[model samples]
Target: MKKSLFSKVLFVCLIIPSVLTQAAEVNVYSYRQPFLVEPLFNVFTEKTGVKVNVVFAKKGMAERLAREGQHSPADILLTTDISRLVELHDKDLLQAVDSETLEKAVPEKFQSKDNTWYGLTMRVRNIYSSKRLGQVDLSYEDLADPKYKGRVCTRSGKHPYNVALVSSMIAAHGEEKTLTWLENLKKNLARKPQGSDRGQVQAIHQNLCDLSLGNSYYFGNMLNDEKQKVWADAVNINFPNQANRGAHVNISGVAMAKHAPNAKNALALMEFLVSEQAQQMYAETNMEYPVREGVAVSALVSSWGQFKADELSLETIAQHRKAAIKLLDKAQFDL
Candidate 1:
């Protein structure tokens, strides 16, 4: 009897650790860069004793997830831009999350109707003008005014950032009007749309154009970088259409993988992400607006001051993306 009891005790000890080890780690497939998320993940691991395993990729996450199917080890998907999140949703790659924490912290407009995803941070699609031009007050509609012809610059119209902006336009104004705006806005371009958002700031600095469109976080990002500061300094960040619908906004968000092996841990991490501790940390890390209300933005972001964000639902914006792309093609905006 003593020998049998000893064997049973030994088996219990071995299995407990095996189960604990399996339960303590969660895997993630992130489109967000390591530098942007490493601190948050490190803190989470320290607090919860759950290891985070990550695979970083610039693109093709959907295809990979589809290929992996049920065998995929990914418990969570972290990515920037609503377009990517919507893509994953459309592909049925992510599972719905029904967390009271997320629902309470993330505004309804920033999350999916069914809660498949939730925004972690927000950024505005801002219109930037040259200081040489003085403090110019304008709206998105003003970009197409003949008065500003040959004075505007932007990245490609088809880029996801711009696509979302165009979609917002469609939501605000019907398709016909938006298509006309696109054509006129194209006519106003100082040059063919090309390059990244920062490149548009560079163009403003070089006097290529007096006005351009860019994401608000790029202002903070540029100010932090020694070389880019000059380009940032050359322009003033303007939140367009404060008088109307407010500035267009987008998000960096997260979703649970459909076949998450460590689902419970993923849910815990998801809840932690919306907690004030993680919200403030993540906002500071990315130089973005926290999705959680009442969280203070980083000092630099605060310096930019606050503006009313257009409260349009992101799901509505996602619904209009196809039409926005069609308008871009119709106008030959990039050409």
Candidate 2:
């Protein structure tokens, strides 16, 4: 019998998998910068004999996957911010991951209540003030004070970081109260909201403002980066709302794709990512807090000293997002 071209092609395709099986691989679509997340993938492959193929983009990974649907090639979604992950989950794009290692590695405060997403690191919204100004009672709410008028600086209120913080405020307070607070805060701005959180710190050092809001990691990076040392040396770090429940917090998190082609491997990767070693890398390298309980906070972070973190579930922050954005607009936060 003569062999058909189609039969030969199909036979080769079937055998190619056995040839490729010698090397296990995983594909990741990440909204995080490659330098920040690639190191972990390298670490994962080293320990598990799995090679990771990554595609990093600043935005649109979610939309790309949603467009691709079950045909999506992404095995995992790595991102920062609770809102993004929760949005993915709400859209039914993420599948629940019930790994014991993940549950043990991440605390309840950091991970999704439904186990749809797992937090790998934590960020705290913090305040930075001039040491020259001396002791200060800093609070996110205090940003609204009349005394700080023309002495306050911040990134644009529309930024996700600020939006999430505002969301938390709404949950803590209410729509009416949040609107009032944002209006007062707008009146105090040294300059219209502009620049990255780090830029706000730079403005303070330049004497452009007496205070600014930043993520705790920005302080750590500033303190360590040679380029930012002068700005870092000039300020004192203050954790907001210590007198109340605590400062609002956020996280860098991960989730399995709804149709993960490599579900078992992805679960393994998720578990490994929350391990002590990975958490330490997240804390030390990124200047983020470890999601796990016993891991020591990074030395750089610790030097800033300890303060309370808001105990509210992060999901509540996601839930209040719309209300916060509305309040932001109604209060003329941009003004």
On lDDT, the candidate that comes out on top is 1
RMSD of each: 2.3, 2.7
Q: Kindly list the per-residue Cα lDDT of model 1 for residues 203-305, writing each as its tens digit.
A: 9999999999999988999999999999999999999999989999999999999999999999999888888988999889778999998999999999988
User: 203-303 in candidate 2: lDDT tens per residue?
Assistant: 88999998999888988888878999899888888889999989999998899999888877788888888888888876788889888889888777887
Worst 10 residues of 1 by lDDT: 31-40
- Per-residue error (Å), model 1, residue 147: 1.1
Most accurate candidate by TM-score: 1
At residue 204, give the lDDT of candidate 2.
Answer: 85
TM-score of 2: 0.93
